[model samples]
Target: MHSFTVQQINEVLQGELVGNTTHSITGVEEIRNAKKTDLTFIGNRKYAKFWADSNASVAIINDTIDLEPGENRAFVKVKNADLAMAKLLEAFQPETPVFETEIHPTAVIHETATIGKGVQIGAHCYVGKNVTLGDGVILYHNVSVFDDSTIGPQTVAWSGTVIRERSQIGAQCIFHNNVSIGADGFGYRPADDGRGLVKIPHIGNVVIGNGVEIGANSCVDRAKFNSTIIGDGCKIDNLVQIAHNCIMGRSCIMAGHSGLAGSVTLGDGVVIGGSASIKDHTTIESGATVGAGSGVMNNVKAGQTVLGYPAADSRDMLKQWVALRRLVK
Candidate 1:
């Protein structure tokens, strides 16, 4: 961790500095775990009680927080403590390794592939025919980019991820370990002559927009016709499944274990909570939030909050929960 004097930190964060300006801060930590050399934050009002006794020499605090008399601690007051802390953390974060332009000897790159300047292909990876990788793209060990796929500049794909044929990923996207992009959709037809299911070929690809981050072990299926789209700035959490032809709008967030069935549509800024499931062909309007463990079977109006299995409005769900508790009593 990098050390910074409180005065220097003040210059960086542009916060109102209070108390010992010369104190050296070594690292960031939680309030309960902070040491004299560590910086902590009180972003919530409930956490203010811990601040008075905290060992932290420096803290990031909201502008409106109450500072009691006789408190000797130093703090940087900002409009939003959480955002300020995030900025500070970014400044102190270590630099990531950028491999040289040369592909590792163990990597298999087709002769027909187009690799841009400063691209890094790690060991045991495969870049198939006509694949186009943008400048400074990094494919870590065991990554595979199948034929005709295009990856935008500065995108990083971690180990064991697969970008299937014809997929298009936008700039600055991150694909975590074991992510499967553009896998065939789960589409099948009943076989004739009393046979088993017959596979339906997915003819389209997955298109991920700029600055998207797909978490580890998530799978995004190829579309039956057009693209299965993940819009700009969307964040998908670990173990999420985005099925065939699903479309997510810009800045939508899907929490861990959430699943979107085939052709589901999410408007901009929709938030799907952990383990939530959206049924096929459903459309969730902009700014809607689906509560944790919800099963959304139909359309949700803009800015609505839904909860429960076969989700209803949050107010109704709360009333029902209260009624159930009364019955038990």
Candidate 2:
């Protein structure tokens, strides 16, 4: 545990100190789970009542809120308590000692592949032929990069993330555990003989832009003949399925369990709530919101907020809700 005086924290975070600055505290802790010698935060107004019996020595809080405890607990008042706590955590975080450059004996690398400077390939990681990994990229244990795949600079892939052949992922992107990109899309036709279905070959790949984040267990499939494109700054939640050839616009938020059919286009700043299904070939303009559990069946113009099944206007949905509420008699 790293210990710092209350005065040192006040100078580093630029917060006003209302209690003893000479007191020393070690590490950061939540208000509910705090112990002695720890710095706790009270961001929620509901937790204000618990401050009287708080076990921590120092409390980081806002000036306007009243946390009138019987005992004197050191208070560090700031504009935003949550933001101040984040800065304290970032400063006291323990960093691992970096090792000097050396390749392990168990790793195998192709002679023709391009490996940039300052790259680390951990044990049991396989770098295939014709694959290119940019600078400062790290492949952890048991990671695999297929042939002709290009991973940009300073990106990290957690455990068991498989990048298929010929796929392109941009810089500073993060793929969480079990994220599958550039996989074969679900496309099949029923056979005439009634025996089985025929699997259609997916000739295209996926193109994910920079600053995109995909949650765990989500799969983005490649297109049948065109690329499955995820635009820049799009944040996708866990278990979301982005089908083949879906062109998502910039800065859109897709919540959990939401699935889009093939070739759908969503404009910028669109927000989708949980478990919404968008129909194929539909175009939703910018700043539109699809409510939770909505089934979008048509193109929604810009700045529209929709709700319910086949998603009507938000005002209409609320009007119907009021009329239905009185029918319980």
Candidate 3:
């Protein structure tokens, strides 16, 4: 186990030290699960009571709060204990697996494709005509980059991921396993002859900004005319679906199983919880938060917290629920 002295941790956190700096902390854990060699943190006031009884040898605490006077545990008090804990966790994180520069023998690269410096193309991967893979990009096993696609420097596409035609992926972006970027939009028109629906040609592509991380099995559909845009620092959880022409602003977060229908627009810092669904053409303003299992049928104003099916303001939804319960009585 990797260990660091309390003083060393204090230096990195820039926190006020209140106890034994010489003590060694080997790992980090929650207050309820900490061991004597573990470091824990109290970021919220509710967790303060656990400080006195926690088994951790070191605790990172918020500067605004105070622990009990007689507690034996050591402490590092910082402006934001949660942020400090994240830094400490990152410091202790293991490095990612490295690959050799040699391209795998089974990989197929079209002669027209542009391969950049230090790129690693794994077994069974295919780089199609005019595909441009920037320097230091890694395409793991079974990945595919279709014709005219451009993946920026240091981007990574895990196994079974596909970057379809004309997709533009930015630097340091991460496409998790089985992710499909630039897939055909689910748009269709009623056939004139009363036959099956005619598929609308998705001629446009997807433009993903830098630092975007799309989770496993997620799908971002290509646009009908223009691009489906995912802005910088957006984090999309597993199984999420972003339909064609959707434009998401920077730092937006969409949790697992959440979905946005066609032409949806999300302003910066909007958060969509698990299994939430936004109707087509809806606009979610900046900093709005849609709660889990919500069905957003209308535009949500900035800074609102919405919840429930055919979602309403969180506070209003609670009142409605209370009224329904009273009626059942």
Candidate 4:
């Protein structure tokens, strides 16, 4: 385990330290579970209440929280305890796996492919014809990049990730294991002759912007005509699905298991809670937030917060809920 003195931790967080500056902290843990040598954080009132009974020797606390350091313990007070803890965790992060070679011998690279300097291709990885991988790109074992795709500099794709033909990915992006990009969209219609359904061809591709991070098993389908776009700094959680022609603006966040139907539009900074589903062609403007498990069937105004199935404004939903409870009584 990595160890740091209370003084060192305070320096890393740029927080004001109180008491036991020389105390050693070996690891971080939740306030209720921390040991005497562990470091913890109190970010809100719920967590702050547990501090007095916690056994931790050091704690990162919000400046707004009223608490005094007890004997033999130390407190590092910062404007945002959660953010301070994240910084400290980065300092303590373990080393990541390193590739044994720049390009593994078992990897297959097409003669027409362009691989820039410092690129690393792991075992069983495949780079198809006319593919362009920028400098410092890393494709972990079993990753596959199909024909005509362009992945920008410093992008890292983990095992089992597939970037299909004509897909364009931007710089500093991270694709977790099993992520599927540029898959054919779900589009089908009944056959004219009264037979089985006919599949609609998805001829376009997926375009992802810089600094995006897609969690494991998430899928972003290719567009029916032009492109399915994900803007810069967007973070998509595990198991999420983004359908064809969806346009997501910068810094949008989708929690685990959330999804957007075909042609859905999300403006910058939109937040979709876990298990939320947006209907086809629906628009969610910038800064709008959809509550967990919501089934949005219409457009959501910018900065509005919606809740419930066929989601309505949060305030209206709450009032309806209250009325229903009274009716039951």
Mark the regions of model 2 whose C-alpha exceeds 4 Å error after superposition: 21-25, 59-87, 92-103, 192-195, 291-293, 301-303
Candidates 2 and 4: which is better by lDDT? Answer: 4
| Candidate 3 lDDT trough over 10 residues, lowest sum | 66-75
lDDT of 1 by residue, 1-329 (tens): 69999888889999998877445788999998999888999888899898777888888989898874135568788999999999999878988765654689999999999999989999999999999999989999899999999999999999999999999999999999999999999998889976899999999999999999999999999999999999999999999999999999999999999999999999999999999999999999999999999999989999999999999999999999999999999
Query: In model 1, what is the error at residue 286, expressed in angstroms?
Result: 0.8
Q: TM-scores, in order shown?
A: 0.96, 0.82, 0.93, 0.98
Estimate, for each residue in 1-329, the C-alpha lDDT of model 4 and write its tens digit.
79999988888888889888455788899999999989999889777778889999999988888888888999999999888898899988997788889999999999999999999999999999999999999999999999999999999999999999999999999999999999999999999997999999999999999999999999999999999999999999999999999999999999999999999999999999999999999999999999999999999999999999989999999999999999999
Q: What's the lDDT for residue 23 in model 4? A: 59
| Prediction 3 TM-score vs. true | 0.93
Q: How well is each residue in 121-155 modelled by candidate 3, as lDDT tens digits?
A: 99999999999999999999999999999999999
lDDT, candidate 1, residue 103? 87
Candidate 1 vs. truth: CA RMSD? Answer: 1.6
TM-score winner, 3 or 4: 4
Model 1 bad stretches (over 4 Å): 68-72, 98-101
Per-residue lDDT value at 184 in model 3: 98
Candidate 3 runs further than 4 Å off: 68-72
What's the distance in Å from true for residue 272, model 4? 0.2
Model 1 scores worst on lDDT over the 10 consecutive residues at 66-75
Top lDDT model = 4
